[model samples]
Target chain A: MENRKIPDNKIKIPIIPVFDPIEELNMYTSLGSLHTFIKGSKIISPGIPFYSIIYLISGQLEASIVSRTGEEKYLFEICKNCIGVAINPNDDHEFQITAVKDCIVYFFTLDMMVEILSQDANLLKKFILNIVQKVHYFEHQARDLYQCRSSSRVFSFLYDLCLTKGKRVNDHYELAVENISQKMIAKITGTHPVTVCKLFTYLSREGIIKKNKKVIKIYDLNKLCNLIADEELTY
Target chain B: MENRKIPDNKIKIPIIPVFDPIEELNMYTSLGSLHTFIKGSKIISPGIPFYSIIYLISGQLEASIVSRTGEEKYLFEICKNCIGVAINPNDDHEFQITAVKDCIVYFFTLDMMVEILSQDANLLKKFILNIVQKVHYFEHQARDLYQCRSSSRVFSFLYDLCLTKGKRVNDHYELAVENISQKMIAKITGTHPVTVCKLFTYLSREGIIKKNKKVIKIYDLNKLCNLIADEELTY
Candidate 1:
């Protein structure tokens, strides 16, 4: 997982929180705080105050928030070209995050955000723009799980990950499997691990992709996208 | 639905894109362009550039993105208090959005956002924060769908909604269901609308709550929370 390089044909999904480095350098250079959480570390728990938004440069992380009744916990999935938000860093908020492997996240606090937004409505507007896109993304995921078949969902998800964070190599597409797991994918895709395992096995067998544990190397990007598109199969 | 007053309990559900009035005033005082769409209007289509983040103060909206392939479309359910990202405003990305009712949305262009973020890192940070919380909320939903029982998921969803967005009256918590439909509840809970109907009927018959179309009045908030907490027999 750690050695996997982003594959070729991997579409670039750039959230680009700060698309312009010069602007970023001017505003957040002083306000931001940099903190590093090594692998196997718990960054925040339910009892602690909410922390800042941490940007992941490299490594993996996992976090869960318990249900309101505190009876069960829910985990976060999806990474690379993604940003993690823990809003209410005060009491009565639900947030629990842990590093899966050695990961680096930049914590951007609320106070600094307020200060920036206070001066620039354009900044606030940009911030709102990102939120709007994210809501749309999740809503789409929810719809796919119900309306599409499991195989459709799987291929769609893979294609999406490639688009979001994939990099183009010589011919193959290498997905950044930073902290993603089969179990997490199963949960998100509404399939059992065994089912996902079987599906993965099929993809590998068809020479569409190869998996070295968590990292998947796509040998045939066209085939994968085609499967996601399901040109031959009618939904 | 227009007459529905904001309930105190319902306010507990933080609108991830909400801007504090004072803070907002400190930033943007002038209202930007107000884009209007008739009922059943298509706001966005695939391959369209994502140029703005839209905030809906009133009216209903829907958005969907094709999963890489052009064959399938994923629809987004939206209402007031929703802020959406036009992720690829400059690229030939295709995602379609429609208005369910005559709607008015506030649009902040991508150029403006980039300009702001470049000038201020805090602006970028705030945007990241908004995405983080949103991702967290959806992650929680995904987790519940996978791990929790059907009944638990329904009850807990209702309970959490109440905690975040419901209004507390003398003895009951009032839920204003302007934007939430049985279909939406089903989609989020991963249940059928018929089941949600049955669950609601069962709860109303038991005198735990009273449903007036979209308005749900809970007679005992504590008990409702307990129902979710203890995983009591909900149906």
Candidate 2:
């Protein structure tokens, strides 16, 4: 994998980046603090002040998002010599990195990485290439990988959402107030995300759910309960 | 959506790039040549010496990879003001972009874009951000979109590959000499890509297909033929 010929992203199916790991290793070690986490420990989770460049030094890690209801959806794995790319940890929901095995992690501040990158144009280019490769890899996952969840199961998933947690409008009846997302539902319910998109469209047509940039409003809690009980929803 | 303050990729997505389209339009018009293609025309395809930055000024385009056997798998769509990102188009296989509607395209050479970017670092930064968003989008597609094709269907897909095209040894039966990919098969057959991956493992264990970086050897022609005929071959 160590090709000195300026390893490019290959811009295609070889999802893994092919830059010189040795050079990357050198760069990571140049200026970063090392932190060790034991197995089954939270490495980086929600509400933690983690603002740095994350590079795995040893052992294994897994990253995922935990819904407000505490349902965890798998994201990706990190092992030795891998970059743990967190897009924005401070999202509305929760994101976590867990140690699957005893691990050593290297954390570099953004300024330090910028300093290093600014110093070496080639390295900056390489870094850009690797990030492109990674971003490309994850985007594919979002597009596909959705399972076709039965409509009832989807309704049930909607009903059971406990985190934002899932809220109740009156007399213990449920209504979602927060902007719950389609991808999360897809991951959690194993339903084709198209279904979630369709659900939104259907809601618009039926005027069942009203959602916007910041808020979501669900109508007819009894109707949602009825669908769950019937367990045979078509759309 | 025209949200400035330097539109970010949103770290997680809502994948369509959100940079100010007006500013982007100005940049494209500044350095690009306007080329118009009538509807149902091939905008960009394999075997064309297209080494330039591509921006869609207007109209619609579809990008896909055509297998050697003449089978086309849909990749993504490009509408107005979209960046048609081609990673490394000079792969061993074919990639094409076709105009679904009448299109006006802006073609910018790398030097021109670089020159413009060199003038303003903000534009350069914005460009990088947009690229990261795009690369991230495609990667998700590769990961999760594969449907599960049955073993028989998978085998049939393997058998029917006509492009590299699929070659028949001894003028009677076929074996893939070139490295046929699982993603292409998944896209073609709607088979879960994991099944394709499993097929590779099964082949290695049975010593049926031997593959390396440069060479792939397939043994036993009649066995493959019989399996396809019976249509109940279980892996």
Candidate 3:
């Protein structure tokens, strides 16, 4: 593949293509449109009325949910084989801008996503399954945050990412947390920035992970799994 | 509404004529058939290849998530306006038979739900919004678990619940934890049963809450909210 010239407004975000699991384009032939977002772009403005589900091919996106009290941030980070279904039209929430990199996302409007799903049971099942899976992940994250202490929480997060997206090769599992910042992780972990830093430092010191500025390389899969299972807080 | 002598199985969960600020049937209209389960009934068998979401209207439900290592139990006790969306079909995690009260749930296959949402963009949006709201609640719970030390977590939970669902008349807000057991709350709070019991006893002695079996009737709204906002633990 040739290096495509980047769009003037956007930096090209890393996108991994799948040859085997390609979705049938003929499925939702009507109700959706393919949309690309430049880095630090706005897809939907707060207080505006729109409804769509977004599938991320490559890039990072954050949603700011505005409430009467204040604004809350929700990160719809990169996920393979998953799509987000935004169902409310008149419901307005706050969304602030913060983009790590440029990205491409497919937008399936409510009417179109619904029409396609209704017409095709298999596709509908797939969509529902995707939402369910995401919900499961969210639930698991919530549980981890609730049950585990700060030290073990980090291990649990890493272990979970590995389990979902890790690739095993030569006894090590390589994982990816694309466009995810340490501050974002701190919010997700429900801990202070210092706490997250200390946890990362401790893990790196133990040689369990090879930390390279942003990317994390796991050295031992078995040890990582062990750490996740051990709730005694070995670190 | 008159109390009609509907057969035990024939009885449908009572639908609220109107649900809060938003009054619409789009959320619950998809419920074609009503499923009534006696207390302790198993909605989904473990390892069974079934894809259905159970929307609870009344009573308590305990879903045990089974993994290769062990099982974890989650309590879903529904009051009015509280719905449960089970998303276990995403992976191999099966829901084991735990416990359920006289629960009335509307069970819909994945295809069915998608079909409904496809036809009605408004409904789909409502569904997504509903789920997002639930996610927000869980996230708040997780945050409380992380930031607060002990009894404060409990107060925060109560305070948030009141703010979301409480009925305010005059100055006091009527907060009800309906049809849920204290043990179930302990699970939600991630605390020991004895600790919850002790906290409840202290609160009752202090006249903060009037306790009935299977119910905790909060009497003072300001105090509860203040305790929740306070930097120090109240109990």
Candidate 4:
């Protein structure tokens, strides 16, 4: 929510490191391949056979999993400067990633990553820490989704979105990324589209948030924060 | 439940690599320390100011976190050859690890891990992969915990435990480690102690599993599997 003064450090933004300047430059020169995708393009399809690191240079990507029943579940968004690694070679490409906007991504095969690691130990260590931190964040997200109520889930999702991708504009916060739809919000919060719609209506009625098509503007940031705080106690 | 024939490759056992033969040898010689903890001893305490990788050499260790309400929640168990890395230097040590039995653990600091990576490129890659794999596993675990009911949670917990630390016996699968308690099971499954007790009673009455003090032997593994399958569809 953008209307209140939110502390910057409260948000946990994942960082991708360029550990060794010389080694990184050389690795990019030798092994990295740049790929561009148009908005709404599928970057990774299920059942494709490849394992590598996808470093988002610009734009946004959404990762989702399609279940056996053809139900799609949204995982998380990979914003610019973030790295997504596929560690298991045997994995069946269960995760499908699509470009949320026109994007440029750097691809590095597992072998190439290993080669880079060989040259830069600091890079390897940072890579390991990156995954560890991601695990921790996902664990918390899981806990919130499973343990908290639907309203709390929606609030927490918005809070996290603000933390990671929101920009301060005058007295309000605006999300840096665009085209966040109600369906996308529903998927990320693990709620039904109808439920998300209802919650937004309630928030709007209460003067907590205002929705304009795909854009959600928070008018009372502290109110949303207090809602989360109250939800935490009950859950 | 280990009585049924389980395909060997069906289990996903995480493997930690000893990266460089010479550097690994030098690492042990330079900084490796072996520590032994008796049963029930605290291997890691809350608020401790240190970060290291603990490699389980022998015996079992249980990692738990105390909630704000002072309830101890069992996270997971560490068995032999598994490496546990503490990546955050500023962490308040919210996780407390205790030995479930007399245990031998190898300790290496973050600095030493970086040193090891500096010497061995392959090890660094494996380390990064290890954490990535862990992130994936924890993500699944979080999904199960959040999406599944208490019974499915308990069943999945046992299923995962069997996969990771189970050993083949004559007719049944047995856990390699010992001293798994009901309270611990309740904590890990995110259910009430009474609920876990009730589930075990139901399983025992239905001739699916038999519980001895702390060890549980499943007589009909298929039944448990079926329960999971049924639960999955509903959840």
What TM-score against the true fold does each predicted structure earn?
0.65, 0.47, 0.65, 0.72
For candidate 4, lDDT tens digit of each residue in A105-164? 888876677777666655665566566666655545555554567887777678767766
Q: Pick the candidate with the highest lDDT.
A: 4
Over B1-235, each residue of candidate 4 has an lDDT whose tens digit, in order, gives: 4543222112132222111112233345347688999999997776664467887778888766554334465556677766776543444435578998999888887657777776766566556655665566555555555456788777766766776666666777665335467776776566778988887788788887766874667666778777765644321
Evaluated at residue B87, the lDDT of candidate 3 is 46
Proportion of native contacts in model 2? 0.28
**Which consecutive 10 residues in model 4 chain B have the weakest lDDT in total?**
B14-23
**Model 2, which residues run further than 4 Å from truth?**
A1-9, A15-34, A44-52, A63-81, A93-96, A108-119, A135-235, B1-9, B15-36, B46-52, B64-81, B93-95, B107-121, B135-235
lDDT of 2 by residue, B1-235 (tens): 5574323434443222222232554655767888999989886676553555668878877776554345465566677776664544443535678887999888876545655654554555556556644544443333223322256555544444422344556543344434345665555444668987787677667766566643445565455545544534566
Q: Candidate 4, clashing residue pairs?
A: A2-A172, A2-A173, B2-B173
Model 1 TM-score (B-chain only): 0.65
Model 1 CA lDDT for position A124: 53
Docking class of 2: incorrect
- Arranged by lDDT, best first: 4, 1, 2, 3
Fnat per candidate, as a fraction, reads 0.18, 0.28, 0.23, 0.37
Docking class of 1: acceptable
Residues A140-171, model 1: lDDT tens digits: 55555545667777776777677776777888
Candidate 3 clashing pairs? A31-A112, A64-A94, A66-A94, A87-B125, A88-B125, A114-B118, B39-B100, B39-B101, B40-B100
List each candidate's DockQ score: 0.24, 0.13, 0.20, 0.31
